[model samples]
Target: MAYWLFKTEPDAFSIDDLQQAPQQSTFWEGIRNYQARNFLRDDVQVGDQVFIYHSSCKIPAVVGIATVTKGAETDPHQFDLSSDYYDAKSSKDNPRWVGVTLCYQQHMPRPVTLKAIKADDAITELALKKAGRLSIMPVTDAEWTHICQLGGTE
Candidate 1:
């Protein structure tokens, strides 16, 4: 199975929120970026692993693990006029946005802080390290294992 990293604002939706959801699963949506949308739609799939990272916070970190319980599908919100993620140019027959469903796997013993990630050379090739912003991004098996071990969840 492939690995991925999904970022969100902790205050908006923390790992605890996902853990407490019904069936401990939630649809990953509201992605407006085209590149991220493409990954969510075409690359991500059911049974793949995920690192639920808390971004836009005091100390950004990977706080938990999740599993993609559902594969890519049209994001219903893109069709709802009232939704902040609505795309007026998008149609039901030709959706411009897509997402997947993630189920809570387990929380890390302690968050693997961005600082910690940066401090390690082994994971420097990670997209999170080389790229500035990406809501959803791929992760190599080595990177995933290293991070999980560092976070005490391996």
Candidate 2:
């Protein structure tokens, strides 16, 4: 199965929030970037594993694991005028934004901090390092294994 890294600001949607959600599933929405949107639309699928990364916060890190429980579908937020992610150009007939639903799998005993990840030799070439800011990015199998090991789950 393909692996991916999905970033969310802790304040906006933390690992705790996912654990607290009904059925522990939530639509990963508000992505406005075309490349990020395309990852959800074209590459992601049910059963894919993802590293739930906390970004834009102190000690940004991979805090938990998630599974893609549902594949790409039009983001409902795009049509809601009151939502921060609303887009006037998008519609039910033709949607410009897309998202997937991720179900919380488990939280690591300890978050694998970015600082710790950066110090690891095996993950030096990881996309999370080289690409840095892309909210949605592919995670190579090796990188996945390495990070899972770091999280004490492998």
Candidate 3:
């Protein structure tokens, strides 16, 4: 299965939040970037592994692992008038946003801090280094294994 990294601000929706959700799962929504949206809509699939990375925190890091439990589906929030993620121009028949569902697997033995990733030469090709702002991005198997080792989870 393909690997991926999903970034979320800890204060907003941290790995702890996912771990504590009912059944330790949640619909990964609110992705507004078109490119990030496309990844969820097209590339992500059930059973794919996800690295839950905590961003905008004191020490941004890959904090844990999750498994994609559901594939792309129109984000229900896109049609909710009261939802902050609502899109006025998107129709139910032609949805503009999509989301996947992920269930918490396990916390990393130790968080692999962004600082540490940047210093690792073995991870030079990670998408996070090139497109640091994307909420969701693909991960290569080699990079995934290396990071898992760094986090003491492999």
Candidate 4:
């Protein structure tokens, strides 16, 4: 299965929040960027592995693991006028956004910080280093393996 990295603000939705959700699953919604929406809509698949990265915090890092429990569904928030993520451009007939449901797997004892990742020789070529701010991004198999090892999952 394809591997992915998904970033969320810890204050908005932390690893603990996912772990505590009913069935440990939640819709990965509110992605306003078209490219990020496209990844959720067209590239992600059920059973795909995900690196739960916490961004915009003191130490931006990958803190946990999750799996795609569902894929390629219209984001409900897009239709809710009261929601901050609501999109007037989106419609039932032609959605402009999409999201996936991710099921929590496990949290790392210590988060694998961006500094740590950058220092790792195995992940020098990771897109995260050069790209820097894509909310949803692909993770190479080798990078995934190295990260899991860093998180003490391997």
Candidate 5:
């Protein structure tokens, strides 16, 4: 299976929230960016491994792991009137956004900080290093293994 990294502002939704979620699973939603949306719609799929990254925090890091339990589907929030992620442009027959469901895998023994990632020579080609603002991004197999090792989760 492929590997991916999904970022979120910890204050809005942290790794702890995922751990506490019922069944330790949650639907990944509200992605408005087209590129990130495309990743969900086209690439992300069930059984894929994902790194839960905490961004916009004091010590940004990859805090935990998750397994994609569901594949891409129309984001239900786009049709919800009261939801903050509601989109008037999307229709039921032709949805504009897509999302996936991920189940919490395990917390890292040592969080791999962004600073540490950037400083590592082995992971110099990691997508997270180049992905400045994209919330969802792909991670190569080698990069994934290396990062997992770094976090003491391998």
Candidate 6:
């Protein structure tokens, strides 16, 4: 199965939030970036594994694992005038955003901090290391395994 890294700001929606959600799952939404949206709409799929990374935190890290329990679907918020993520230009006939449902798998045995990841030359190709700002991105098998190992989850 494909692997991915999904970044979220802890204060806004932490791993704990997902764990506490009904069925330990939530619909991933509010993605406004086209590139990230494309990944969700095209590349990501049901059964895909994900590394839930905590960004914009004191110690940004991959704190947990998730599984894509549902494939991509139109993001309903994009059509809601009251929603902050609404796109006025978008219409029901031609939507501009999409999201997927992810189920909480497990917390990492230990967090794999960005600092620790950046220090490993073997994982230098990671988007986080390459200065990527996208909230959602793909991850290679090797990178996933290495990071999981470092996090004591392998």
Across 1-154, the per-residue lDDT of candidate 4 in tens digits comes to 9999999999999999999999999999999998888888888999999999999999999999999999888888999999999999889998888889999999986789999987887786667787778899999999998888888896
lDDT score for residue 69 of model 5: 99
Per-residue lDDT of 1-154 in model 2, one digit per residue for the tens? 8999999999999989999999999999999999999999999999999999999998899999999999998999999999999999998999999999999999987789988888888886667787687899998899898889888886
Instruction: Select the stronger candidate by TM-score from 2 and 6.
Output: 6
List candidate 4 stretches off by more than 4 Å. none
Residue 59 C-alpha lDDT in model 5? 97
Q: What is the Cα-based TM-score of model 5?
A: 0.96
The collision pairs in model 4 are none
Model 5 agreement with the true structure over 1-154: per-residue lDDT tens digits: 9999999899999999999999999999999999999999988989999999999999999999999999998899999999999999999999999989999999999999999999888886667787668989999899999999999988
Clashing pairs in 2: none
The 10-residue segment of model 1 with minimum total lDDT is 123-132
User: What are the TM-scores, per candidate, against the unseen true structure?
Assistant: 0.97, 0.95, 0.97, 0.95, 0.96, 0.97
Question: lDDT score of model 1?
Answer: 0.92
Local lDDT at 117 for model 6: 86
Q: In model 3, which regions exceed 4 Å deviation?
A: none
RMSD versus native structure for model 4: 1.1
Itemize residue pairs with steric clashes in candidate 1: none
Local lDDT at 137 for model 4 = 91
Candidate 4: lDDT over CA atoms?
0.90
Task: Please provide, for model 6 over 61-85, each residue's C-alpha lDDT reduced to its tens digit, 9 standing for 90 to 100.
Answer: 9999999999999999999999989
Native-vs-model 3 lDDT? 0.94
